[model samples]
Target: MIPKESRNELALDTFIKAHPHLLEEMKELSAEDRQQQILWAFEDEAESRGLEAWELALELIAR
Candidate 1:
């Protein structure tokens, strides 16, 4: 997993962890672009969980 300190960073690390096949796909993007995608995905998960984006990111990061 990536050593992440922020929401977007955590999102990317979480995404790649959950989807190993997508790791290769993620590697092709520029860092900024990859983080953007992960941010979107993280937001989606947060919404589904009825929590704010940063809240979930922080919780996940802690674990």
Candidate 2:
């Protein structure tokens, strides 16, 4: 799980705030683009946590 402090550094809440626009665009994206965006966000969060990529992938997938 991501710590609260890490969440701030990753600007996760900020990203989520901009999600409406992203979501709208996402609807028009191919499946691969959607997956890429999710992976990018996951990687950003994982970097903030000093976690491995696989860990982040698992966490994100679980959600």
Candidate 3:
């Protein structure tokens, strides 16, 4: 089962549709590799966008 924190209040299908190539790449990775990639992506995204903006985005999407 996916963790709620990982869900980030966004639909899985929506994320997949928005990032099909990244999703496909993730499927090709080992479990550990994919997890690290995801974590790094989250880190990079948050750093680029700012943590406050990231929180706001999550709130907006949840609504």
**Which candidate has the top score in lDDT?**
1
Clashes by residue pair, model 1: none
Evaluate model 1: give its TM-score.
0.58
Candidate 2: which pairs clash? none
Q: Which parts of model 2 are misplaced by more than 4 Å?
A: 1-25, 57-63
TM-scores, each model vs. reference:
0.58, 0.44, 0.50
lDDT against the true structure, each candidate = 0.72, 0.61, 0.57
Q: Where is the poorest 10-residue window by lDDT in model 3?
A: 7-16
lDDT of 3 by residue, 1-63 (tens): 546656553533343355577667799889788767765665565567666535634643575
Q: Write candidate 2's Cα lDDT for 1-63 as tens digits.
A: 876556443553445454556656677778788757755875676889998766654554445
Off by over 4 Å in 1: 1-12, 21-28
**Top TM-score model:** 1
Give the CA lDDT, 0 to 100, for residue 34 in model 1.
Answer: 78
